[model samples]
Target: MSFAKEVKNELTQMQTEDCCTLACSYGLLLFSRAFSVSEISLLTEHSGVASLYCDAVALLSGYVADLQETPGGYSQVSVRDRQQRINIFEKLGLPVQSPRKQINLANLQNECCFGAFLRGAFLACGTVTDPTKDYHLEFSIPSAGLCEQFIKLFDEFDLSPRTTRRNGVSVVYFKNSTDIEDILAHMGASDTYMEFIGAKVIKDIRNQVNRKCNFENANAKRAVASAGAQRDAILYIQEKRGLDSLPKQLRELAQVRLDNPELSTAALLPLLSESLTKSGLHHRMKKIEQFAEELKNRSENEN
Candidate 1:
């Protein structure tokens, strides 16, 4: 389907028992824009529907803009566009317009405006048919504290967004579809809108890791299974090496690596004491890993 239609269909169904006026408005604008309708005849067939159809021609245009700018900083939404979306929210009267009512905050972030995340960040010119659900949204924030700001925002609004740390970044996943819909409603979104907010969340994360490791750099991926190994490594070290007795250097080094699984061994080099060399450092790391693996195997045997 065309990008506009896809957006329309998604928005039409954004409503649920918990949905309110604001979400409905945002959904309508998004739908009308996507379908290329000038005025929202569905709500009130104004003459703008006839003349404004021209504006609808570019409903998916902004989403295209979001795709081109990511991995680097993205272009901010235009003042006029922002105001228009706000108008939609005001008309609907979404619940989240707390500090300021009649103001929709959709499109505030690419990854998380109405709903959608991750893949939305990579959308090109056309409409992305995938229709991102929160279940698929994941993030690896470079800073845990900064990521918490978003987490709190969603939580406060009674929406659930999750975060898990990987490498040096905290990976957050917005896994609830209900929360996604609630956010869309909270933003005074129309049932017919297209959200690249998903893109912002995804890009916010990828841009962090991508700047350091892009699809070109062999795609730096870590398996979830490896996390247990690392955890076990820490536990084993503490148990066998007597985490307390292990020299301060060994304990500190292990903690840094385990805590920030994404950071390479090289990154940990500097965090070590001035007296430590890379080889000496590597040697200690190897012992921990080997011991952890051995413990894993033994545990499986006993089980």
Candidate 2:
């Protein structure tokens, strides 16, 4: 099941305030596919949302809507009775004549009601991505004006959502995992919210481990390249002036590096007969490299 469906299922099991539930039902019907005085209709693929809508309407208007299941996995719920539709509008505080299809927050009694309203809106047209893959929650609004209004509602709760238009529909979305979690929790899907948090923790740990591994690999590559260059310099000096011509300490360090070309300066420390700190060994290797470079430059100038 989709994360969105999971959330709706959880919502279906929760107990909500009667007035708030009615307001939520109002939101779903008003913003859904069709809402008019003569006919109130909603189409959904989620059987849970369809049932919730039918029940919420029945609770509010005292009339059960007709649920028609089509061949394409859609459940269409409609109240074709004109009086029932008018009563639903009156119960929802919607004008009986040409009411604007916008969310009226005043109908909601409290924070719980507001949350329920958002839940109903989500049931109508919201979707959330699997937290294991990505953080995304969006609502497809039918118009830009309604989209902005919805954004204000989110802002009231500090959801920090963004909006865009796609194919003539306005989309309100949030990418932040924290925002998504807070939204789910606000809508009373605590279990799904906890699951999202767990997924986020796992993803964060994996990312941290990968970063550490990449950093260590980079350091290893740099060390290998440096060790290779040092060995090459030692070979150049030995070929040109011979190791015996160098200072005794430099000669011994050069021989040790030549024998163990793969070892780092720190590793070569224990191999030396005269003990030296890692930095002391590095200093000695630097002098040998400088001498080799001078020899090569002079040979080039002479040629």
Candidate 3:
């Protein structure tokens, strides 16, 4: 099953006896889906979600929803009777005719109610990506007013979410792993929350290892290239100016470099009879290159 479905199933297993909390959850589910005074309908692929919605409405308003199982593993639970629909709206304190569709925060009298409301809304039209692939949890709201209300609700719970549009639906989404994990935990999906945490830790460790390896590989490449350039300079100086023409210190450093051509400047340091720091070895190598450049200039002048 998808992670979203797994969370919804977990939510269904939670038992709530408070009428206000159940009504609030019913309100969120009905208003968030295709609901009206004359007709209310919810279509879902998960039987657990459909059953949860039916039970919530039944418990709150004593109205039974028509449950139908269709092909392709879909369950459709709907209230088509006008009185039943009105009963649901009235029990939840929602007016049948409103200028704008918005969540009535008055129904959410406590934290439990608030959580139940969000859980119902998720069962209605929320989805979360598998944490292994991406970090995303979103609610597909139908109206702009409802979207704004959902954002405020997130803020009230100290959750941050971003908004976007897709196919005329307003999406309130969380991309950060922490935000997603917090949401799942708030909704009482402790197991899925821990699974997300595990996935995040593994991903972070893998990325860190890859970055360290890349850094070391880059340093090794640079060291080898520098050694090659220094070798060429020393060879040119020896062939053109002769080793004896160089100053004593330069001659000794150049011979050390020639003897250990495979070694980087730092590695060549300990091999030298006279101790010098890595920087000191680099300075001597630069002087050798300078002598070689002078010889090249003299040869050009003669030509």
Candidate 4:
């Protein structure tokens, strides 16, 4: 039949993760844009493709989880799929650390349901030219907590989905460029992305350091300037003997204004909580300005 039908057929037959013929098909499609042995090498910086599925899955799942909702309750197919995926750990004879909970990845990476999952995502992508237009995330969250199990399956990198309901036929979007990029990034394929390409991790780190340093240095300078300006104004007030003394509320507002010289009255409104009304925030700033003028007059008188 069509490519989409072939994907569905493949997904039906596969149960666990390893590497699949379909994933190769999927990779070929992705690589059609640009592919290289070097890209794969860079992606597997820490380990081989076969072992990094969990980390890859977690990243991919988190991306999808952030997008859409799923069915609310459990389904036989979903349950069956999860159990089968979990069975990979068992099949590899990996130790189940606890009596009830078993199938730890470290013990049995080979047993992971990864191959099937990668294929599913790949197959889904293969059938779509436009995922957003073609499908939406439609997994249901159930009271029986199928969502939890669904997340677990999703975490295995064996599945990627989007929920869609059209003509009352609920369909999950499988793969798209966005999803594939997410998957590749999850697999440590940082070099393939714009920000993460050759200049990504180092550039990001450098930019972060620059941001922190700039903020701290600028804030420190502002704090010193504000403190000096406030002190000078206070001294001028004392010297001028204006209105006996400034009130505590007025003084605090004055200090705040100097401390945040760039702050607009509207932004200052949040700090006022119960302190002022819409107009009152502006009024308070005006009061500070008038007091500063009065201080200037007193300094002039003393001089």
Candidate 5:
């Protein structure tokens, strides 16, 4: 199943008290596809969410909503009876004819009820992308007023959310991984939240390992190139004036390069006749290259 479905399934299994049940049901109905005095419907791809919606309706209004599967393979639950929709609104203490659907903060009895309400809203209209792909969680609400209320509710929990409109639906979304994880945790999906955290840790470690490997590979390439250039300078000096023409220390370093052309400057340091730091060895190599360049220039001028 998808990660979002997994989260909803986990939420559906949570145990709720009388107050939390009412609060959660309010969220589910308010954010559903349609929730008014005339009609109350919830359309979802998750069967667990559909079942939860039906259970919430039965518990809150003493009415059983019609649940059916559409041709497109979606579970749709609807209460078409006008009396039943009014009954639901009465049980939830919602206005029968509000200008637009909005959250009833009076239903959220306590802090725990807030969490439960958010859980139900998620089950109704929320989705989360797989942590392996990206960190994104959103709720698609049909009413702009309801969407704005959700944004304020998120702020109450110290979670920052952004808003946008897509296809006439108001969407409240969070892209930060921490925010998504917190939302799952608050929704009582502790197991799914732990799984998401594990995925994030693994991804972070993999990225760090890749960056370290790239750094080492680049360093190795630079070492090889530097060694190749030093070897070319030594070869030129040998072919022109010969090793005997160089001073004692320079001649010894030149011979070492001719013997171990593939070794880096640091690796060649130990093979030197006299003790020298890496910096001193580098200085000597630069001097040898300079000498060869001067000799080449003089030869060219003479010709």
Candidate 6:
């Protein structure tokens, strides 16, 4: 099953207190596909969410909602009767004719109820991407007012979410792994939360390993290029002026380069007759290249 479905299934299995059940049912209905008097419905791909919706309705209002499987393989639980819808609204303490649908804070009796309400809302209209691929959890609410209320409710729990409009629906989304983790934990999906964290940790470690490999590969390439240039300079100086003509220090370093052409400048330090720091070795090598450059310039002028 998808991670989002797994989270919803875990949430559905959770037992809530009587007061929290009311809040959860309120969240499910308010964020569902249609919750107004004309239609009280929840359309979902998850059968567990559909069953949970029906159970919540039955428990809260003593009205049994119809659960139907659509041709498109979706589970739809709905209360079509106008009286049943009104009864549900009254039971959840929602306004029958409000200007805009918004969260009823009164429905959430306590701090724990807030998490329960969010869990129900997630079951109703929320989805989370596979943590292996991406970190994203969002609630697609139909009403703009309700989306804003959801954002404020998230803020109360120290969760930050961003908002956008998609196909006339208000979407409140969290992209940061920490935010997604917090939401999952709040909803009591401890198993899915740990799975998400595991995926994130593995991804982070893989990225770090890749970066380190790239850095080492780059350093190796640079070292090879530097060694090649030094070999060329030594050969040029030997061909034009001869190694014997060079000063003793330059001559010794030149012979070392010729013999140990595969070694980087640092590696050659240990093989040198005189002890020299890396910077000291580097200075002598620079002087050798400068002499070769002077010979090349003189040859170019003569030709």
Candidate 2 lDDT trough over 10 residues, lowest sum: 97-106
Inter-residue clash pairs, candidate 6? none
> CA lDDT of 179 in candidate 3?
90
For model 4, how does the per-residue alpha-carbon lDDT over 241-301 read when each residue is reduced to its tens digit? 6424777666666555545666654555566425677687656555655677776787689
Estimate, for each residue in 1-303, the C-alpha lDDT of model 5 and write its tens digit: 889878888898888888898888888888888887767899999888899899988977787989999999999999968887778777777789962466778889988899989988888889999999999999988788787778888877899898889999989999999999889888889999999999999999999999999999999999999888888888898898898989999999989988997888889989987999999999999999999889989999999
lDDT of 1 by residue, 162-214 (tens): 66766666565655545544544444344422354564467568768877666
- Report every candidate's CA lDDT: 0.43, 0.84, 0.79, 0.39, 0.88, 0.88
Cα RMSD of all models vs. native, in order, equals 21.7, 2.3, 2.6, 18.7, 1.9, 1.7
lDDT of 3 by residue, 102-209 (tens): 677767777667767777778788889998899999988866777777788887679878999999988989998999888887776788888889989999999999
lDDT of 1: 0.43
In order, how many clashes per candidate? 40, 0, 0, 23, 0, 0
**Least lDDT summed over 10 consecutive residues: which range in candidate 6?**
98-107
Q: Which of candidates 1 and 6 reaches a greater lDDT?
A: 6
List residue ranges in candidate 1 displaced over 4 A.
1-219, 222-232, 239-242, 245-249, 297-303
Candidate with the larger TM-score of 4 and 6:
6
Worst 10 residues of 1 by lDDT: 117-126
Ranking by TM-score: 6, 5, 2, 3, 4, 1
Query: What's each prediction's TM-score?
Result: 0.24, 0.90, 0.87, 0.27, 0.93, 0.94
- Measured with C-alpha atoms, the lDDT of residue 37 in candidate 3 is 71
Q: Is candidate 3 or candidate 4 better by TM-score?
A: 3
Across 92-125, the per-residue lDDT of candidate 6 in tens digits comes to 7778885135677888999889888998899888
Q: Rate residue 274 of model 6 by lDDT.
A: 93
